[model samples]
Target chain A: MDALRITHVEGTALPMRGEDVDTDRIMPARFLRAVTFEGLEQHVFEDERSGSVAGDRAKEQHPFDNPQYAGASILLVNRNFGCGSSREHAPQGLRRWGIRAVVGESFSEIFFGNSVMIGLPCVTVSPDELHELMERVEERPSAVLRIDLTAGTCEIDGFTCAIGLPAAARDALVTGAWDTTGLLLARYEEVNAVAATLPYVAGF
Target chain B: MGKTLLQKVWDAHAVRILPTGQTQLFIGLHLIHEVTTPQAFDALRARGWKVSRPDRTFGTVDHIVPTRERNRPFLDLLAEDMITALEKNCHDFGIRLAGLGDDRQGIVHVIGPELGLTQPGMTIACGDSHTSTHGAFGAVAFGIGTSQVRDVLASQCLAIEPLKVRRIKVDGVLPRGVYAKDVILAIIQKLGVGGGVGYAYEYAGSAIDRMSMDERMTICNMSIEGGARVGYVNPDQTTFDYLKGRPFAPEGEAFERAKAWWASMASDADARYDDEVVIRAEELTPLVTWGVNPGQSIGVGGRIPSVDASLPDQQAVADALAYMGLEGGKPIAGMRVDVAFIGSCTNSRLSDLREAARIVKGRHVAPHVKGLVVPGSVAVKRAAEREGLDEIFRTAGFEWRDAGCSMCLGMNPDKLVGDQVCATSSNRNFKGRQGSPTGRTLLMSPAMVAAAAVAGEVVDVRELSAEVAAGAI
Candidate 1:
């Protein structure tokens, strides 16, 4: 795979206003039964969007259910989003649903790591700025939000806010160090050499 | 001037600093289970890569395995496919698999310690979030996603940033009936759910030091619920004693040398912490989560926390209260329960079973309350049955079953039917976490779950333990 470089992302924004949106709610445990993450986009927020109880998905009311937010590529969320479960499926589902970047007041550590690894840049903005941005995004649905990571700013029609990414994470996105799988594979011999000396490996 | 245990372990395992400034740390132990490993193994196959150190990796089948029906070709085709993929992947990769029917098979976290694979000073990684459960041994263990799991399978290392260590010190003695589960719940309640973000919690002080290895595991298992990526207790004599003569532990002289090294790896007496928070253990009571999140909890005798307009997460509190269908000021102890689950990687150990059995031995499960006890592993199952704990549960109208992560997230057959309210010993209380989207879960200790099963409502385990001791049944 080519090294990932995410310098900037520009798209219509989908706003989810809530604190501590957990992974279980992002992609319910029932949907996690699948062996692969394939076709999980349709099931994102399955419970909240469809109001399903047990495999029944008829009623629908959540914001994601609205056709207005269709094809939106930028996700706008509130504090401590993705706060529970270390399941990567949460990020994978969001990615599959076409989200390229997320601008939120805050993010859980694991969720941030998972999103960064998958080439989705999660930027943190001040709460006041986030609220202003969310209002602008919801009010002007036709307006495109531009998130320039290199410039460290999120801009829309009537709002512009400074966004923050950890320096190391930003470096990864800029230099393509985010996808280290190739780099890891390059050091195969060194890894095996270290493994050979460990007592547990030797004993086996 | 002294390094903390986390720093020492992290420094020892640092392979190099990556361009991203994340440490390319070597993983001493890599554990995998059925649910998360299939996609990871597939990722490796797609890259034409084989496991770098199969000898250092271990596999097991949990999450999707049925606890009651032990027969092959599981009724759920999806569950069967997942387990089969794990077995095939482990075999092809030359990794040891503790699959069903194997004596070593169990929850990845439980079996790692039981088989002596989880040792002090190790940097362990697993695909499951509860990997922190092994931190009870003083190891630096963290959960990884499937992609990271694939990374570990290919290179036996992870590129990760270091975490600041927060020392959470709980002093004094814990009152009777308050288990480690209650201690963690209380901590999460006091410190909001997101309080531990970007930090590794080092549980310390007299209270933590006095806890058994099992209790420490129970405390660390729920670190994720508090938004901490990892939580641990320093390895002590108790940790070494628990590992003594286990199936894979060091032998005789080697054991002595390993113990010395492990003891030396403990954080220094004068180690400086980034932050410290102290709690009086004597003041703690049995805790139960009152809302959808684990942090929204109250003591057994306490009422739900009223939503304060001054609180930052007011909307969050309101949302949780709505999802739970609970009034803010109502008492939690008498809340009705439709089901009671006494299992999970958190509280399905031998001691957990013994304590719950002590409360359930001569009692009948309340009518209309479905109770179930799933041991953490096959060995735990056999051990419980050997000690008649299984009999106690079965006779009390509880389904005493084989080992798997049953009803905890409910990937298997054991799930909450419809909007049933369950008193559970599992770690998470997230909405629909028990499989049914509308099902409600109350997180508590195993013995507390037993009390709920008997009373058909949440009750103080201390009250039941007192009654049982008084021989009033």
Candidate 2:
């Protein structure tokens, strides 16, 4: 089977400035009523984008609403992005909303895992470097940024910085092994063998 | 060197090192709920894959189940459709489901332990982030996304990277008013919300050892809140005792054998951890989150942190303050609470209910405050009602509700209306966490929520304890 290798991602950037932005904010709990994740992109940051006070319909000043960053496929964020709730919907919504890659100072482990599983690469840079990237994105929302998973670097406007993706994650992305179900299913016998050895599974 | 429980459990479950350098670790148990399973089931059908270990997988309807009403064709049609989808998926896959109207039905985390399905030396995967709650049994449990859920269903395994283990030791006895909720909140405050990323937390020391199984569950439940996907306690006599006669636990001689295996899975005395953090239980006060995230908390007696422009987290602090509509430097104690809630996988067990009821026995909820007490599970609700704890809460003017994740994430009908400030016993104070986009949450222990319910504001639970002792009420 041919694997889909994602060696590099290049796109216009959208900068959302916040620290510890939780999944609940990305996709509120009410939107989770659906049986499928379809149409979740429309509700990404639904509450944050629309002010909730007194049923106000005025759109909040959010980067997702900024016309300059319209159609941007790269998300630039600050420290601890996607920090709460293990909802894969957070990344799914972001991906559906056209965020192909995310570059932040840090990411919640589950969010990182979920993003990688869906073929969306989440890479990290130093806080200082991330601030610079956010500034660069804000200065020119149309600036194209490129994330090289194999090279482990992010470059924008002739400026380059080291990006951090765990070696395992990077290898998986570059090899298109991120959707791990097929890979895991191939080792079915091995899985049963391991389970059989456990006292709990083997009934002591 | 000796091995930590994480290493031992991981090594035991590991099938092989994949070509991508991730481990193919077998999952012994896979728990599913309404919200995250339908898409996974669809993916499985798309691939024409059968559940590899249907016996090991269990399903429950919780997230979108309404707490107040439980009739066919739910008031929320979307919720009914989601639960119906889960039922159909579970039925098609031959997975056991504790759906609505089943006594076993409850929050997945609560029902798992209550039924003894969560055991030590196992790898538990659930579609919910709070799956870490199962780690209280010494299991290597963590939350997985829908794709990983699909992987587990197809292969009973996950391709994942290993994590470093951090030993968090909290010594000494907890103060009178402090509880496991406070201990975890204190730990999150000491360690930033993102501090535990890429690591598993091994909760040790005398304080953790002294906690009951429920308290330990409360501690492990919020590991995800601290960016740690897994947190656990070492199995001991307490763990064994809790599992002794549990419905799913082994019987007679088999139970003894399982105990031996479970005890052996505890971290060796000389085990090496990647990191260690030591905290004193005496220093901790009943903590309350004053900001949006769990880490932005302080002692009830302490003031909300004032934002300093020079600090790197200044923006975060400022934003939280702005969103919470509170001034920094103000005491967290007397903040007006429009709602008081006690329930979630975090603290809706029998003990949590009993403790909250203790404070609500003779006290009436403040007229202006909307008080709610939701039990975590049907079993918990039954147990609390058997003990007449529900009567105490109802008499105190708090709405005693059925079991579900009500008002916790607010996927159900129980939710805050607007910008109401709620003193909640559940975890997570993120923006719109309790249903209303503008609703604000102040997370604390159940007793503290009860105190706030009566006082119409946040008050130190210790003060209320003292009042009870003094016969002031």
Candidate 3:
């Protein structure tokens, strides 16, 4: 696990292009057996790079090759970003593929929840803000997008925008916390307390 | 003043209703798969806890298992290890698992119902979204995350928030060409994807009542698309008849004892609901999604809505259109597609494939398209193969692969390429859902997708009535 410090990178907006990019495309379905997130970065867009699945040999530049948007990590995508089967590898692939966070106009609820649970910042931005961010990335590829979850702002060039995440989700991302352990530890108490009120829990 | 069916079930299963408006409900049946169980079992072992009810739990080898070859030392090392781990877990815990080569070995949802293990009035939980498919038998089934998977294994119960019941009543008669796949697409269209969040959908009314057991499975399968944690239809004669002769079903005196019990679990005719959304069957048509979400849909024979929305009512319409690269008022039919998939828990039953095979009989695949037909379970595959549905699918240029989640989510080898459009029978038309980030998926019925494959584009099954009406096929 190559642990890198999240350096509060600026958020550049780009309405995620593509529909139904299931795990196979995100990290190739073949890599689901890869035990760990090691060496997954190279397989990010295996379909496009290998020209194996659905190839357009004539087209020189697929979406991933746009020179202006090189090295940008925070992706702004359209609705239903991940809607296929529940393969954890899709998020792992994105996390390794330079996508520190995704600000989507909308997200598959499961994908969004899982991303947050695993420490990936997936926020829902208004459509206008989504479009503006995409326009910014297109206009200036070298332009840094200052995405600060601590400040609740995605600043690209001269524009500063708010990506509205529910406070609970926002707080978890800002503080670099995963509440899975705490939630699990508290379940016994929660169950007992509720059981006391209902009385049947004791019988069970 | 009235107890809805949901309330009745909730009360029956509730160990306690929590202050947070959730319930600590005991699960009657818990199903496990290969991928999600390892971590869950590890979590249990770390706590040194034993499985609470091994007899009530069942395991299966799917998701990670390779569909093609059936030998040891599997090509995918991680999958082989996961399979080995499950075998050990099931053996150690005294839980029964339907390993491959066993007749009962099939997709969790498909086998659960077929073996008569899935009973109405029970709560079924699995670490899979399509667990709702068992709801066709009136069982209250829900999908859980991995951690929740651990909880079920340890305690045979879940801490869950109570769901509001949305009585999604479909009335009148469906058109000749429309199937359950179309019914669900229409429902998602009427209610946005998140419309059913925090709710359980009770499928009712004349249209739903008229469907077969297979069709009911299709409707309940996509409840997740409506953002409902669970969706179900009340048990009726169709559910009873389907279970009567199955392997796991109780027989004779025991059957009589069970049926009487099952009957009592059906929603009372006057059951009240938290919310109700009604749609006339006549208003619905064979529908397909032209956008990234299932909600971005249009009726068969309709044109893709244009993205040029200069007004307010047209905003969502515009967003859908732009993302899909659809031109306003362009007919959805006859639009070119590169692939077609006919399978999923949603529509990979014998009847669904039979309908697709019936449509594609004596037809040649379009030179420009790639089509596939995967059955939902091994039983479904065997039944279809018995009827020689494989030959028809193969003869029509589709790859007749083994039963698994083939292309539904592209977890296995099935997927789409960049910008290539697919007419799929599986649920969800989200962006890149078929494998390529740029790949587009259009949700439709198996027959509709067959039509698209035959025509090399979206074509309404109603127009090509030759297969059903003309009998030329």
Candidate 4:
């Protein structure tokens, strides 16, 4: 993990508009069969789109079938995004799917943790500001959605929109401290001191 | 203040204090399952570590081990690899593994108590979240993450923050048909999901004290759903009676010593609490959730909250209403059900099955709905079948399956097909959590699921119970 560095990669924003979008929709449990955690980009949102074949033709039945937000990365969800199970695979599925970060009005607590743990930056914009961004995404599929972690803003068609993140999470993203094993390792002395007084632990 | 059970266990287990003001606690018992233990065991091996306290640890295979078929190497290749790795690891580390076909094979939580491993005045930690189920015997139990799992495997101490204690007292008595499942669901509704985020809840009051060991386990099982890491009832005579002749429980002279020790763990009558709330058991009703979250619930006779009710969580309510295709203020009961599942680590014990069987005996499941009853453990399965409850379930159109988290989170073969709406006895009701992303789960009691299975609708279990009481069946 690099020391707190943020790089902005401009991409084709594939926005899937919906509410209460859950983890199972993000990654089908069947795909969980493959070991080594690779070859998953094709399966992200399997239940949502039947298959993860990227396309632009709009269909009315499925929520992701909205014409305006095809091939979008920065998902502009309505509210209470990812309100479901604590499966870490949810955010892993999103990252594998070409989605960089979510700019939703709010996120479920477990989803937020899953996102942060897997290095997918989830930036929360105010509901009103988020509404404006979603409107722009819905208004123009080709419009650019720029999320700058350093700037703490998302730009829709060069129009800047503010978002907020907790300082620890923000710093972690800005300075690439992805793995937290070091934090625990650094406290070896402190942890051992506490462990010394216990007997059962001596067996471990 | 005199020591409450919480304080006694907390003090006895306190290893050291960290600068963060949390106590470094020693875990007397550690349980590992196949799902979360592989990574942890790998971490230990990578560090050239041996399991520090193999005697204090027990391993079980349940999550991926299908209750349907326990054949060699497993049907799922990944599950087979998991079991293989776990078997190799346990052999290498000298830790006993309760592999499938072993009498001890069952959900980690269920096997612990049945074997008398979940003793009072001990601090227990496991990688699985429902570890609080062991706390019914007055142990201080909490679920740890994988990293923590590795830590416990390598070193038996957990660097943890001490939680503030809160007392919840339920007075009087519960009305007929209001089981422990309803009580936990009701608690989640009243407290919101996050109300107990940082507190260890001490369930007090007369109702708790009067409950059997099985009943208390149900209440503590959903402590995590309420955002509390730990929930427990004080050890009383009921607890002692239940422990009398278990395999691991002390015997003869040792039993008296153990009894005295267990007695010390109960909270002093005047023990202090950080917060206190009381509920009247008489006021509780059979409860059910109308949404994905456990907190979105109402009593059996109650109507759903209106989106216009001015609650701050209204959007959540709205989302739930929309997902369920329900209009706000509608009654949760009488809704059509396509499936009914009665199993989970949460409520698939012998008592739970017996209660469900009482409702389904001589009755038939609605033609349109499917029903199943999966026991929590092999012991539970054996006991249930010995009593012929399994035949009763089969006779009523309910499938009798072996033990595991079947239909609980849909990790195994049992799952909801398509968009079927299921009345489930599991702990969670998240979207697609029951196997189909579009599938919906209505969390209720085993008895309630039984009632729904027979009626093909979410009927109040009380009405069915009243009829059963009157020998209408």
Residue pair clashes in candidate 1 = none
User: For model 2, how does the per-residue alpha-carbon lDDT over B1-473 read when each residue is reduced to its tens digit?
Assistant: 99999999998999999998999998999999989888898999998999999999999988888888788898888988998998999999999999999999999999999999999999999998999999998999989888899999999998888999999999999999999999999999889889999999999999999999999999999998888999999999999999989989999999999999999999999999999999999999999999999988998999988888877768788878888989989989889999999999999999999998888889999999999988989999999989999889989998988788989999888889878999999999998999999899999999999999999999999988888878887
Candidate with maximal TM-score: 2
What is the C-alpha lDDT profile of model 1 across B371-419, one tens digit per residue?
Answer: 9999999999999889988888999999988889989998898998888
Where does candidate 2 chain B have its weakest 10-residue lDDT segment?
B310-319
- For residues B1-473, write the lDDT of model 3, one tens digit per residue: 55655676677777654332335677778999776677778878888878877877988876666567767887757777778888998998899999867767767777788788888878888978778888888889987756567777887777565777889999999978888888988888888776775689999999999999899989998988877768999988888899888876777877776777777778887777888999999877899888767777888778887655465436566545654668888888777899999887788888999898888888978998998887777898899999999999999898887766667666555667667888999887765566665678889999999888898989888777654677766
Q: Which 10 residues in a row give candidate 1 chain B its minimum summed lDDT?
A: B11-20
Which order, best to worst by DockQ?
2, 1, 4, 3
Candidate 2 matches the true fold with a TM-score of 0.98
Error of 3 at A45 (Å): 10
DockQ (CA atoms), all models: 0.57, 0.80, 0.12, 0.14
| Ranking of candidates on TM-score, top first | 2, 1, 4, 3
* Alpha-carbon TM-score of each model against the true structure: 0.97, 0.98, 0.78, 0.81
**lDDT of model 1 at position A199:** 44
Q: Please state the i-RMS of candidate 4.
A: 5.6
Docking class of 2: medium
Candidate no. 3 TM-score = 0.78
* lDDT (Cα, tens digit) per residue for candidate 4, span A79-198: 556643444555766777667777776665446645765667788887778767767665676888777887787787777877877666676567665334333444455555655544
lDDT of 1 at B396: 93
Candidate 2 Cα errors over 4 Å, as ranges: A1-3, A50-60, B471-473
